[model samples]
Target: MKTTRLAAVAIIANLAFATGTLAQDKELGEAVTIELNAVKSNEGGCTLTFLVANGHASQIEKVVYETVLFDSAGQVDRLTLFDFGTLPPGRPRVRQFSVPGIACDALSQVLINGAHTCEAPDLTDGACETGLILKTRTKIEVTG
Candidate 1:
């Protein structure tokens, strides 16, 4: 009987997550806006630039995100943690990621990873990533 109850609880949790009833989508991702800043490729490697803005009243320490880079042949994902030092409540900053040996042509798509790093100033809550607002300035595709 106990096992069945446990299973039922687990299923309900999953259902809640799938329905966006949790605070993950609604309360989070309100502090910052994420955008594609640029993408460069060369012998060195592929560089991806991103802009993160803090729209709330609290200063954020860093913006950590996961990115999925779909290349010509496969996909590459990375959890990028950038220390913005301090976003000062309403400022935006650009963070860069450089991956050697990967060219721009190989990149087919770019997706932002989930959940916030939750790093923030002492006076504010740490769920900065949850409060961030995500945006796309340009498509993550490369042209010859």
Candidate 2:
């Protein structure tokens, strides 16, 4: 009888822990989402497209990231700042950058090295890094 009670308590504790974890996961998913939407190669160069969404309560006036581009062989091609201007709350925006010399197929990874600018009146100091989610729809991988 004592063993049965202990088992029941253990099950209840496990269920509570699982519930808390699920809530945390859901909250994290609702944060800022940066998706590498597409990459196009033209005569000039390769244009990389990003789909950015702000899930915060306040609007971001400007946010820039020091981005690193990697070649197909995992070598660093170049580093540039991408200014995703004026991200409104709960809205998705598309931003594009053109590289004059890099081919679209040559890029295998993109990394958000750090935030160069994150301007918002009401946001925290580390607002740009907090709960940021990175995704990629193309073959190239993206990481923060």
CA lDDT scores, all candidates in order = 0.57, 0.81
Residue pairs whose backbone atoms clash in candidate 2: none
- Distance (Å) between predicted and true CA of 46, model 2? 0.7
All candidates' TM-scores?
Answer: 0.60, 0.79
Off by over 4 Å in 1: 1-29, 77-85, 121-126, 141-144
lDDT of 2 by residue, 39-137 (tens): 899886899888777777899899999999999999999999999989887666778988889899999999999889999888877777788888787
Model 2 global lDDT (CA atoms, 0 to 1): 0.81
Per-residue CA lDDT of candidate 1, range 67-106, in tens?
5666666565433444444565555556677877677767
- Give candidates' CA RMSD values in order: 15.5, 13.9
| Candidate 2 deviant stretches above 4 angstroms | 1-30
The local lDDT score (0 to 100) that residue 49 gets in candidate 2 is: 85
